[model samples]
Target: MNKRLYLELENCIGCRSCLAACTQCGGHDERNRNYVYDVNPLVNTQTMPLMCLHCVNPACARSCPAQAIQIHETGAVLSALVEKCIGCQNCTIACPYGIPKFDTEQNLMYKCDLCIDRSKDGIPPMCASVCPTNTLQWLTDEEIERKQKQFNVKNDKWVTSIHLENETNVRVNLPGILQGITKLY
Candidate 1:
């Protein structure tokens, strides 16, 4: 049940395919609603994609006095019960990544579900599926570790960190050449 999403910033080609896919899957109006942030650090040529890290101790979950946020068993998925949300904006302020978006029309908060709906059909997430350079990857923790080790063997840098908040877990890292590239973004 230990799953994670991996981002290879160096491999990223600044494509917005993942962003488009995420918005489309979330809902019809989500296209302009969802976004993939592109940051190019002054020293780095590669672009870094910023999104929800789905922290184990999710600040958003704890901040949500309404208890609208929940993490699935796999630990990679975070969901917001729109019906339960009170539109307090606590989750938005609590989230360090600022991933949760406030829906002005619906008066609710929305963020990435990691495409849980698409997973029901045994499909990879929109971002991963459309990545031409294979920059974004989703895998179980064990699988991620194996790949990390392989990268280490090749003298690649594997920076890993974990944080827990509000009964949610967040694991993040940059691998290989992407490590330095991501920092620039």
Candidate 2:
């Protein structure tokens, strides 16, 4: 198992704390993973977070000319190596999931390293740590199995019936989790 971040898209409230937490300005870790993005889920008044799938066969690593990208043994894909990265954006272009970003001012590329510094000590990533609704999570083996069994939504399509304060009914379609996902009904 790759053992990366897993998101329960239905629970996300679009707070952008995950996005903010990914950035240094949010005041968590100094170096920015800066990978999370928000996208429409074909529904009104809602969005879902997206990030690197950190593929078993990563296009970013294969496409790097500078050989800056490295996949850790724990399956976390690190951001571009500062000394080796030429800021070519090859990884960005080559990524099937479009996870990488080039920083113009810094002249380097950045992506989620799964918070390697923190996770090494068994800490969850800042995004997961800060999520208010537990929308985003990192699952253990037992948790993964439990979620997989409890939730019926597959990777292809996502739906969660929600009723608003005004009793407005909305039907939403989630694209899928970036990596592994499980949810509680």
Each model's lDDT: 0.63, 0.64
Q: What tens-digit string does per-residue lDDT give for candidate 2 at 37-100?
A: 4454565545577766556557788899989999877667778888999988899898766678
Q: Who wins the lDDT comparison?
A: 2
Per-model TM values vs. the true structure: 0.76, 0.73
For model 1 the local lDDT of residue 14 reads: 70
Candidate 1 lDDT over residue span 64-153, tens digit each: 888889876655445568779888999899877778888778888877776766544446666767777766776666876787676563
After superposition, the stretches of candidate 2 with alpha carbons farther than 4 Å from their true spots are: 1-3, 25-43, 152-185
lDDT of 2: 0.64
- Candidate topping TM-score: 1
